[model samples]
Target: MTDPVDRDSRVPALVRLTVDLSALRYNYRRVASVGERTAAVVKANAYGLGAARVVETLRREGCRDFFVATLSEGVLLRAVDREATIFVLSGPVDEESAFAMVRHALTPVLNDATQLQWWRAHRETPAAVHVDTGMHRLGFDYRSFSASIFEGFNVGLVLSHLACADDPPHPMNERQVARFESIRSLFPDAVGSLANSAGALSGMASGMTRAGIALYGGNPFVTRPNPMATVAVLESRVIALRTVAAGEPIGYAATYTTAQETRVAVLGVGYADGFPRGATRDARVAYGASRLPVVGRVSMDLLHVDASTVGREIALGDWVEIFGHTIGIDEAAAWSGTISYELLTRLGGRVARCYTGS
Candidate 1:
């Protein structure tokens, strides 16, 4: 008997995720151009696009600073680029993690007093301080903030997160900037970073911008047109085709009934592949310029698309793009009732990631 894994590798993948490294580099330059300096946020495995490749691609484009959400992520990234400054956003929860940060040369973003204490006790290298401006998610509270708390610490960076950076007109952006500025002044010698993806795009970044989703081609602004290039293209193969008569229900739960004769194409991708099941509502897949509406419920391993409009143009084994240059990721994410961040990060492991334009 042959090995199942080897046999599977011999065949073509049903689902393909093509990452455009050139486009990713383009996006980094575009975002970095808006601020004094920018750091790449490669957390969540670079938003499920693969961190190792994204880090290498960005490093070639002159990016030296990187950020991750956890100590393990920082360690993994440190292994990729030994010299790049990697900041752990979640900070150290205990003495062992702090020691690991020092061993890996990973800087911890001290979030609270306890984390600060941990870093101070195991202090071997400089650490960043995250001052809570308004997000209230992480970091030290700016309301009762005092520079004395970090009196003898070698604070390399002081940063804050913007809650409403996506909405340029939101007042919170202004308030956060003002508060962050006050706190940043305390660590005058340290680098000040107040911008995330949206903030950096909108020119709200201070000394150093932490670019996250925008680096992967996600739109930073909420209402404005996306200025970044498309970096990831998700495609799936058509495995089967069928014709449904009028009044015939299609797929599980019998949600969609054909009013007229319809041509259906079964795609080899489903919710299990990170194509959200909720996207069954007003979702679509594209073949060139033709858009095919997704009907009925999305299964764990399969989905049905109404391909009648294309007639016989689409055939078995034909590749249909789930989202890419033709169909924007943001638009497809909206159909799933989620954001691009969630959609990108939720990509299942079975999908083969192919890199191009390196």
Candidate 2:
């Protein structure tokens, strides 16, 4: 629980997403030990934890491979770094964006036979081919994979995505693995890759695994332990505090009525800052060492919490942890009825991210 900011130094008032760089490095190294090269997925700004900084840190930690979801993200990641192996997961759509892939030196994951053909016709650099076994979002159909679609291009990695690896013993787990293994033999020169964070943790094939959410310490497979670093916590300042009489309504539409004479502490964070609106009266914000229950409904700019039991020392300008340290991301996601990955990825750009440790 080291202080995120320099307590003795002066800094501007802003929402800070304090990141533990050391924890991230430790998680990458730990996940890489599973006997395969770990490609850090920096898609969606590294799941809302700033892609540029995430790639920079991971690169320094010896991560040579990186994955981004979109062409734009690939461009931004390439801007930050040029030497690392940056792969675009969306693959190429047409000739226009394909040139961007070449310009940025991004290796597109060819998902379909058409894109494969498109790349084979227009692409000059090495590209990865995605074969769909299940989780039919991207990648080529199981039937078309054996066609001449991938004949001429220099394929870097024969990739497939995992859908049910989070379930561990899910029937689809072995099915997709078997399918990927079967088809991968067709392309001998290309390296094989299967497994995401969950796949790697589930003892899947020993190929390159793309570590995304788990690298940031989220367990997609809740049954098993999270195989990464500590959860990232977020804290914001309480800008105001006041006493409300019993039966007084709070927030818009008078959704929450105060039970008794209550003390409310207003936090600076709100939905616009990526705090979910569903985080209503059930959510709790941590103040100092004690947890204060958020009363009433969450608003766009602020949320109120009961702090009557909190001492008078707690006042305006005091800091309250919204999701990190005590209130884990899992709890926050549960309260919001979403996964921790959503919570992390939805963290808005308005909130400033501050990095700590090496």
Residue-wise C-alpha lDDT for candidate 1, range 229-294, written one tens digit per residue? 999999999999999999999989998899899999999998898999887468889998998899
Clashing pairs in 1: none
Highest TM-score scorer: 1
| Pairs in steric clash, model 2 | 233-324, 234-324
lDDT of 2 by residue, 1-358 (tens): 1112224324544355778888888888777778468899988888887777778888987889999889988887777887999999998888778888888888999887678766765555799888888877888888556646556678879888888878988798888888989988888777788988878876774768898887887775877765566647687788888999999998888988988998888888888777899874567778767889887777777878889889586878877888777777777787888889998888765576777875
Model 2 compared with the native: what TM-score?
0.93
Candidate 1 matches the true fold with a TM-score of 0.96
User: How far off is residue 245 in model 1, in Å?
Assistant: 1.4
Off by over 4 Å in 2: 1-11
- Local distance difference test, candidate 2: 0.79
